[model samples]
Target: MGLILTEDQLILRDMAKSFFDEKSPVERMRALRDSRDAVGFSRDLWKEMGELGWIGILFPESVGGADMGYGELGVVLGECGRVLAPEPFMSTVLLGGNAILLGGNEPLQKELLPDVCSGNRILSLAFQERGRFAPYAIETKAKRDGDHYTITGRKSFVLDGHVADQIVVAARTAGSSGEREGLSLFVVEADAPGLTIHRDDLVDGRNGAHLVLENVAVDGARVLGTVDAGADVLDAVFNRATVGLCAEMVGSFEEAFERTLEYLKTREQFGVKIGTFQALRHRIANLFAEMEFTRSIVRDAQTAIDEGRNDIAEATSAAKARCSEVAPLIAGEAVQMHGGIGMTDEEEIGLFFKRLKAAELSLGDAIFHRNRFAHLRGY
Candidate 1:
């Protein structure tokens, strides 16, 4: 899908593509996995990305950002996905950073955003519990103390919990599980006395952690937004994060499709290239169509976020659902078309497949987003 990019957008996209291709290629992920890197990504690369101003693309200039929109950020994410760049970009910038930017008070923003923008701090959002995608299904409890809050709960599948300097946690201050009204977000230091982080390496060669908070104390000033109004903040953050994930999925599936096409052109069967077969050609054509459709949906979602449109929720859900649905399909078909080698650890296609699978199940799967979309549309 050829997006009508402005000069700056084109320049940004090209720059990102060049940087990731040179600095953090798919080969880098393979290296990380082979060496069993505990950190899962390079701090040097992250700082370099910060120096390039990629981390600040979506924020305002007042907070040390470039004052760019989600569209520009999406462009960078797409390039990262293309090479399966193993960085905390999505977890830190999209999830944790957005949570703070949207939900934190002005003072909190001034204190945190600069560090985040400079890559001096790593942050993660700890909201998921019971392995569920529903943001309101929070079981963590944050009891209000005299001048602080004591949080007690376990958060599963926190994106960067293992290495985060700070974590944004959603806990029920008043409401029951699955109820939206009583949820609250708090910034908890990863080294808090009663907090425990159980790191787990995901199948995609990325690191995640299960966070256990046992009476973890947080200052009152660490609360993000109102005490019992975090549902709105979570909703906004998830929607933007979903769009960013969709953008990455688009890049991933497109690359998978391209790699499959190249394989077909060269891998011969019965004395002729597989690309010469009508059946394979038809399948490739279908996959190409799906990729383009997913790209358009992602572009629309990014634009909706940038414009602050009334239908941002609906658009984001649609984009996420469509991307989730098609990404796995493309990845699976790419593997199948490549025969046995595609499944091997040495094959790059397998890595892309794993990454796509992770993205498919990340914020929400297709079924989850489809239901959310229907509910948002008054269905």
Candidate 2:
């Protein structure tokens, strides 16, 4: 597998970089956070992204998507990371949209994916019900009553859940929580009766919603896959989303490192540039090596997805573990090297620090992925 981007991928990266630089800068995220925007991100900007085919990269042509691979999508996500764009690529495209695409029946795909491709509908996955990232530890229960099911439970850390047009809810239809079997996925509308959504402003300046479902009713047709086998779908979705998040983390740390390096060159200490200090230079040199190593592993995971390798689980876990390790180190070093300025919200480097920390904990932290990597290797 190739770690380097092809000519076409490079062109796509350049185009996406230019688009994000022009349309969605760090200022946009700051503005959204400061105003506590109801929608968090701009739908008009999302529609523009749809018009440019950025939202449809993972979907098939039958659903108005570009029928592309994760490599292309990773490139766009990396650019989004560079600017900290508060878009729903992770919530909609990777989590919710992929769940439907990979597991849903054709009619459901035809009904929902088209709108998703056009950015007309936002989607989110309500899977995490606890404090950590346990995929199968779902307590939400769905009871089937003839043609409809009554769902009752709560979900936390539902990314973009406040604005999602539809939510892919994970409910236990058979087995108990923490068991891989007997889990089911159902598509529930955001405005459905008996459903409550509480919007939360995350530490990273992004938005997540906590949802409380009280006897929420869903038709049997909304089920994404088999009645008691949602873990399969969840596994596939999480793998891609984890790798995509790793790609974003790579971009974020790379940007933070560059900005810190620039500051070292310009900021003066003792009437001389701080970059001249041998100790500081050594630190930055180590940071650069870690950043490049992270970039390579992330690229390898993305390539594994695109190439449909059988060992995608191993590759993604490795990538996430490495990213989880390097991102915090880079962010911390960047902030420390910048001194007082990095501690404030007014500085851009601080934003990267927050985002990197959030990303590190998003899918799974370093220790979690390391254990997962070991298990996957049959150790």
Query: Could you say which candidate leads in TM-score?
Result: 2
Give per-residue CA lDDT, model 1, range 231-305, as digits (tens): 899999999999988888888888899999999999988999999999989999998898888888889888888
- What are the runs in model 1 whose C-alpha is more than 4 Å off? 1-3
TM-score of each: 0.98, 0.98
Candidate 2: tens digits of C-alpha lDDT, residues 67-86:
98888888898899999998
Question: Residue 78 error for model 2, in Å?
Answer: 0.6
lDDT (Cα, 0-100) at 33 in candidate 2: 90
Over 4 Å off in model 2, which ranges? none
Checking candidate 2 for backbone clashes, the offending pairs are none
- What value does the lDDT take at residue 295 in candidate 2? 86
Model 1 lDDT, full chain set: 0.90
Q: Could you tell me which 10 consecutive residues in candidate 2 have the lowest summed lDDT?
A: 1-10
Distance from true location, Cα of 105 in model 1, Å:
1.0
